[model samples]
Target: MHFDRKNYSDKILIDLYEALLRPRMIEEKMLILLRQGKISKWFSGIGQEAISIGCTYPLQDDEYILPMHRNLGVFTTRKIPYSRLFAQFQGKLSGFSNGRDRSFHFGTNDYHIVGMISHLGPQLAVADGIALANMLKKEKKATLVFTGDGGASEGDFHEALNVAAVWDLPVIFVVENNGYGLSTPSNEQFKFKSFVDKGPGYGIDAVKIDGNNVLEVYDTIRQLAENVRKNPRPVLVEAMTFRMRGHEEASGTKYVPTELMEKWAKKDPLQNYEAYLLKEKVLDEATIKKIRKAIQNDIERGLEKAYAEEMPKASTATEIADMYAPFEQKVVQPQSEGKNKKRYVDAISDGLKQSLEKYPELVIMGQDIAEYGGVFKITEGFVETFGKERIRNTPLCESAIIGIGLGMSIKKQKSVVEMQFADFVTCGFNQIVNNLAKSHYRWGQNADVVVRMPTGAGVAAGPFHSQSNEAWFFHTPGLKIVYPSNPADAKGLLCAAIEDPNPVIYFEHKFLYRSLTDDIHDDYYTTEIGKAKLVAAGENLSIITYGMGVHWAREVMESMPELSADILDLRSLLPWDKEAVAETVKKTSRVLVLHEDCMTGGIGGEISAWISEHCFEHLDAPVMREASLDTAVPFSPPLEQNFLPKGRLQQKIKDLVEF
Candidate 1:
């Protein structure tokens, strides 16, 4: 706590003290609000303010911090207006996320800080991406990311650290060892002698610091920040501190030992810092009280405004559709260079290639994506063309790979991440649904990412390789799901997905990759999203499908030419154009919705329900749904065929038509 007066300016010392006080006061007011029932819940950082405050010193204009829930003091140090902060926590319209999210789950792009969600593990990779972006842009700026001991143990933590080190990214990862991971003690969290030891293993330089000592923490961060900016290497700094309270107010340390609580109370960062300042004659008692009073007054002022601010309307939660609104913005009416006959796989590759030509900042990454061109050879020659920086070959870590795209998209890289197989998406489901899908709604920023999911079966790739997993993403909000059935739609939709300003789940049918072929436009153009294609027109009935289902429906129609029906290819499901669906359903009174996924929870159910609700008067028969059985996609060719909707689709349509 002692510092030479000549070495450390009195102003710096006072600023650090104020930084600690601001968050403390905010947290105290939050506790009061929670008790009053004005705020629903709060994750109190309480005694751990020093780490959030201390490490934020000497922040440059271009620099940004990715903070955990506990790091409210980082806001104080970054000069985030108390008005927005208060409004955000209060779920008011003025909140950073427009009250779309609560607590530390909001962030502001203008403020240069991306807030963390409850699953904060993924943000490490995200921070690495932001830093990678700045490095790619040659910006002399760094991103500082904070995490707790619990988050440090997540898979993303190691993945991000290794990637950061390998890339020599300018990221300073600080782990706040606050004694507990929401009730679990430090001894139970890690067996390691020091968490800092992880740095050297990952090829990152690291250090452990006194988190409670504001001056020491600040000086360490300040010095390391210099090394990060100048040398551009990922650095790990573990800050030893204590929560000194339960995870949140509700927990109340009922399970925590009283003696352990007492032990940390004696080392309270606030009291110790005040005592140090007083002992060093750096701050008089009157001056200290005045500073504390000022911070309290500011908190009161902000809280009053927040209380007066209007809460978001009931409709705030609904209409959470594709972020790319008023679709005219992404219209690409580029000149076409005749037609080129291509397979579905090559068409998608062409789309990616053309997307890169248009979006200079576009990058694609996945397992064996670079040199090997992926297992399907869809990304073949992409690495050689885009180079390793743009076309990255990632390790076999789905969570980290998807997390990298989640971060890259936020950094404006317009990333396209391919899952080796759609079934493997389970590996990174947390990042996909929680990180990529929730980014726009939670942060009010553009997280334009295209996750190319090669879904569906025909390849007999078994349960772990082939899956009609569109149902999973269809249920999640804030994602644009595009499933193209042919080469033309695949090319155009993939192109549009890349340019669209939102997180898009592009499902490319692995079965149709090499099997399907068509002469597609060899020009830079974008297919309209949310709009379905009328593959064939008929007035007797309507057969709505997407992906491999389109082909199945087409084949059925060829045999049953008498049962004439309009085949509607719903290119995308998340933002399925309601108007288009209703028109088709109304025109052809009997409607059959089909999909390759299980019948129980398939997207066919949603479409069937919607048609029954919206086009009820126009219906000649109850909306029919034809889909695979509620079972895993079997490996055996016979079981797989029976598991698919294709075989039963014809009979189901006949039954519906007769009915």
Candidate 2:
């Protein structure tokens, strides 16, 4: 409710002061490196050092942290080697991210600086997840999540706050109110005067502090962190600080007024804290000078070491790329193997049933997934089979639905989350893109979660209900995207996705749920992720498609026996089988790409490009693409049919055979 200063021993005060100053020098060196062309451009924390150091001081060595790009002070306090920091800026081998991530996107699990996401607000969800995991593990630690006032505007921020509040997860969300997001000020970004005010709405304890005062920040975070560890509830601390530099090294302050800049510079957080130390007799003038000199020397040494270090070997790049290497072997069909046969939904039911039986830690949470057995009845009889504790029905908040899943996933539990519909997924986009995709890449910890959504435009569910947005996830790294058209593949892929070591987005075709059925084995089976399935073989043309589009192509192929059309279903999008696709194209001289997404910037574009580049000589004609019209999927039957890629398979086959 109110800010209070904590009394500390003289030695502790001096150590805090030194910690606060170390990052200031490092920030300066980074800017200099950028100017000298030794490193790429970066955003400097500058005057916000006090907040970064202050929040970090209270965190225990084993506690987790999720920082934004501007928290250079936090990185220094966590003891991330300054050389690795510089190497990251230089985009070299010694970089913490191995040159995969840009400057400011560094993370280290060993230091408990769990993760850092550059795109902003999504880190909040990750912080919530880490906190939830800690609680489940019974670890006496809290997670500190840092973001700017600008990031607070994202929907994921609200979702994370609410979920953390509901679960009473041990998390402290530190909002670095640095007055500007790029050039836009906080006042222009939100209707609320302070971000702390948004916390109470989510049932989180909220407070605001004078972020320029290092001691005030230190005291606030220390108490909040301790409270979180004890009570294990979410708290929001809005630190009102100032950004004394341009948004990034590439940005100029030409748009910033001279008078305002000068005014803020006079109250620079680092200088103000130094004055406070002197006034309180906590740090003498000589000690302050010595500390500054020591920090400067350390930074210089780090820079020299970083400059001398070799770039990450090209092999390291291949290794990083190999992390998601596809499982190449063919899936052994359950029915063919003489196992008991089951439907696609039955396989999902059985897999989850087995998961519930095998792993007591696993829990199922989503809207209407418990008693109602989900809107699609995919979870039919699950609540009865697994009981309410394992099968939970959450509130009608899509963001909250995903946020809870994220939290549960972090706890090392197999959390199966379902979005009622795929089109409504925009409500939880921030969670999927920012939190899920970056969790392992940013934190070096596996989320091991599965998100199942019924997708595709059919049954005239209308614009809102019928839409395929899998392309959105396909473009995002660190997330596995699986779209299974047949019941057998759906069940098998869903099982594999659940067991994956990473977060998986499982897209189930709504049109195929009951309308189409295949003979599947009763025993559990899993299709390899990132590997495509060749449904029908032909030599003339390869019709590469996924989800409902695959079914359409199959229908067209069966109708036109004279047209030799080979069909390949790419079940997984990211880490997709480029090798298999290239090989297939080499055999078939013509290729046609199809999907349910809008034609512009659809998944087809990427696939077409890949084929054209890798198997160019194998093509008999320019790759043909058929996708839904560049418009919202219509609700009317005729319009919906007209909007989709109807009869494109026949035309593609005709062109390929004739060519």
TM-score for candidate 1:
0.95
Compose the digit string of candidate 1's lDDT tens values, residues 548-567.
88888889899986778899
- TM-scores for every predicted model: 0.95, 0.85
Top candidate, metric lDDT: 1
Instruction: List, residue by residue over 1-659, the lDDT tens digit for candidate 2.
Output: 12233668877777878887887777777677677887767787888888888888888988877778778777889888888878777777777666767766756767767445555766676676667667666788888888888888777677778777877878888888887888887678887888777876888789999888888888888988888788889899999877777888678677678898898887787777677778877878898788888888888898899889887767756555534423344554454455545566666677677656756777777888887888877778877777876787766657656655665565566788788888778887877777666655543456667888788887998988988888888888778889888877777887788777677898887777667656776666678888898998987788898988888888888888776667899988876889778877888878888888989989999999988888888888898888999999999999998898864557756876676
Predicted structure with the largest TM-score when compared to the true one: 1
Residue 504 of model 2, lDDT score: 87
List of clashing residue pairs for candidate 1? none
